[model samples]
Target: MALAGCGTINTVMREDGVAARELKSQKTYCQSIPRVYSGVSYNFCRLNGEPNPDGAFDGHLNFVPFVFVDSLISGILDTALLPYTIYRQSADGSIIIR
Candidate 1:
C-alpha cells in the first residue's frame, strides 16, 4: 500500500514510458502540481484526459481497487505532510510533470 499510490509512484518512482507519455497527453494547463494533496492531483491528472489505449492493461484492471484504496491512503499521507509540503510548495512551487 505504501507504494501503490500514483502520487508516490509519480513523485518517487516514475519512469519515462507509457505512463509519462499518457500524463503528458493530459494536456492540462498545469505546468506543475502542488505538493499539497499531490497524490490526489496525480490521480486527477491520470483521469483528466482521454484514456490512453496503450496504457491500459488487463492486469492493471485488476489493480483498480487497490489504486482507489491507495488514493485514500495518499490523501491521509498528504494531510500528514501538509506543513512540510506547504514549505516545499513555496520553495519548489510544485512538482513539474510537464
Candidate 2:
C-alpha cells in the first residue's frame, strides 16, 4: 500500500483561497461535502512492533489490512455527499424556519 499524507479529513479550499462552504439550504452545496469515517487501525499497528512489509515479501502483515479497508472507505467518502438542513435563529434567540 502506498502511504500518502497523514490520514485526516480537511476542508477543501476554493480557487479564491477561501475555504469551501456548504450552504445548508442549498441542496447542491449540501451534496458536495463528503462523509468520512474515523478509523485508526493502521496507526495502531504502526505504533506496535510491526515491520513494514514489501509487496512481494511474506511476513507478519499487521497494518496492510487496516490500510486497505481505510483506503476503500476513504474512496467512498471522496465521491458521496449528503444533504444538510438548517434552521435560522429568530430575534428572540429561538430557532425558526427561515
> What are the Cα lDDT values of the candidates?
0.59, 0.28
- Report RMSD (Å) for each prediction in the order shown: 4.7, 15.8
- Which candidate comes out best when scored by TM-score? 1
Q: For model 1, give the RMSD to the true fold.
A: 4.7
Candidate 2 lDDT: 0.28
Clashes of each: 0, 0
TM-score of each: 0.62, 0.25
Q: In model 1, what are the clashing residue pairs, if there are any?
A: none
lDDT of 1 by residue, 28-84 (tens): 444556677877676666555555466543333223455576678768877877887
- Model 2 compared with the native: what TM-score? 0.25
Single out the weakest 10-residue window by summed lDDT for candidate 1.
Answer: 56-65
